[model samples]
Target: MFEALYQYQGQLLQGLTTTLIVAFGSFVVGFLIAAVLAPAAVYGNLLTRRIIMGYVGLIRGLPELLVIFLIFYGGTVLLTKLAGRYVEVDALTAGIASLSVVSAAYLTEILRSALLSVAQGQWEAALSLGFRRPRAFLLVVLQQMMVKALPGLTNQWLVILKESALVSVIGLEELMRKSVVAAGATHQPLAFYLAAAGFYVIITGISTLLLKAYETRLTPHMR
Candidate 1:
């Protein structure tokens, strides 16, 4: 087991790198999209609100693996149709796009919940103090909302990180995919998978601690 791990250390490290890249990229893109969509869902017109609601519902309803398959395969087909020839959607692109879509749904819910958690009275108080709607939201409401939102967002980040393993299905060569390959070749499935789990645990532990630190900074009184 140890020999196999030692021999494949380079491959494992490469997989880890790919995993981190996909997870971080997806999280950032998804969170930003959610940031915009959350406000729209919370404050936009009826048509806009309904559209956002439908998107969130659809995403949340599907499994991540299924979502990945659909995006990669469906996108390829759509591109082929548009170009009037067969087109291929690369694994990395499909993985990121699918992961982002799923993450965005959760992020939208988190942000909307945080925004609503900040009472209307706070907005009123800000306005009474001569702050405009935009300023009040940007300054007062956003500060409180972020403090409330951090924990949920961090949880979502962790979720995305783990869900990244699903990207291996489309041959992305992330950690899980590499582990599968190593397991097949070395005939040491348990050892290789255990190593993968260990890596995931380490990353999770570090992220959890970092998020806790950030949360304490955001809400010192709670600490």
Candidate 2:
């Protein structure tokens, strides 16, 4: 095992790098979309809320594989047609886009629920204090909602990290893709897969600890 790992250290490291890039990239973009859409779904006008709802529903109902394929192939086709030329959309770009859209749907639900969990009395108190509606939401409401919703958000992030592995299907050289290539080359499927699993476990374990620390720091002081 040590010899095998030593031999493939470069490939493994490369795989890890790609996986982190895809996961973190998707998370950042997806969280932004969620931040916008979730609030709109909950608090915006009827039309805005309805549109957000429809988007969430459509994304949630579709399979991730199909979403990836559609974004990878369909997006390329659409772009090519619009440009009136052959446009190449790489696997990485397609994977990132698809993952962001899918992740946003889930994050929207998580954040919306978190926002709803904020006590009505808190909003009332902010209003009574002469804070305008927008100001109150920004200052008094969103902070509490973030605290309440962090655990759910963390879970969503973990899901995104795992889902990034599926991007390998489209030939992105992320962890699973690298593992597949190594396994094929060495004819040692179990060894490579087990190593990949260990790497994933290490990443997730570290992430879990960091999130927990952040959650603790964000919690309100108790008497």
Cα lDDT tens digits for candidate 1, 1-223: 9999999999999999999999999999999999999989999999999999899999999999999999999999999999999999999999999999999999999998999899999999999999999999999999999999998999999999999999998999999999999999999999999999999999999999999999898888887
Each prediction's RMSD over C-alphas, in Å, is: 1.1, 1.3
What stretches of model 1 exceed 4 Å from their correct place? Answer: none
TM-score of 2: 0.96
lDDT of 2 by residue, 1-223 (tens): 6677678879988999999999999999999999999888888999999999899999999998899999999998999999999997899899999999999999998899999999999999999999999999999999999998899889988999999999999889998888888888888889999999998999999999999888888884831
lDDT of each: 0.95, 0.91
Candidate 2 lDDT (Cα, 0 to 1): 0.91
Q: Give the lowest summed-lDDT range of ten residues in model 2.
A: 214-223
